[model samples]
Target: DGVGLMTAADVSAYAHADDGGVEAFVTAGVDVRGWAARPGEGAAGVQDPGTINVVVAVPAALTDAALVNAVATATEAKVQALVEGGYDCSGTPTDAVCVVADAPGPHREAHAFAGPRSLWGARLARAVHRAVLQAVVIADRDGPAVRGQA
Candidate 1:
């Protein structure tokens, strides 16, 4: 899986959202730590073919609708980044991102954030829920060996 962000340095550079070139924009005013990508071996995220984790700057309202909306926005942005980086998700960008509960029949995982919710908490929740559920399915799965990766 991968990590996602609204203001990713690489993506911002790739998107070239700034008036200046990517490096100049990044070096002058970007958060060096800002990044968006699929999670790595030790990080927390949904385990699937190519899932990504992300963070977005959300307002303080903390509405459920707002949360969902933030998720949607982050999802699209992340998927687009992936596509630009060469993910062939067809023309449906949404297919690359979805609510964790609705995994589109593919094994996946994701964390939610409410403006100021701690990143540690969200990632922990996603890891626990997704891992446990996938483990349950694996244990119950028949005619296949259940093994964990990462």
Candidate 2:
């Protein structure tokens, strides 16, 4: 019912970032225009199909709290990318994100925090941001005829 962006198939991007000993990898698939909307700007309770999907992986082990914090950081980075790319909305209603971190080892210390200011969190955010930005740029370049399908 609205203008489409990027082809519905294989429209994705990947980005990686490293800081100190922390490393992060991000993969993003973005196909939003018909469904893009800010958190409070769209219908109050509509759960649409997920149009933007991001997967973030880090090499360092993280505590439970850090894991949860990584999710928030990634989401924020995604929103930042969308906004920087000229998208009026934060993201599609059903945007999905998955975060993965190494399992704690006997010798490895688990990080307790993964906020934007934290070392690992900062790398994760940059990686996610770069991946999302690449995806958004691809969508914009592809114009308003394709919607991420395949």
Best-performing candidate as measured by TM-score: 2
Q: State the local distance difference test value for candidate 2.
A: 0.67
Q: Estimate candidate 1's alpha-carbon lDDT, on a 0 to 1 scale.
A: 0.29
For each of the candidates, give the backbone clash count.
Answer: 13, 5
Best by lDDT: 2
Candidate 1 global TM-score: 0.28
Per-residue CA lDDT of candidate 2, range 1-150, in tens? 122333223433444555554444444444444334434455566443336666677788999999999999988988887767666556765566777888889999999999999988998888888777776555447632343322
Q: How far is candidate 1 from the true structure (C-alpha RMSD, Å)?
A: 18.6
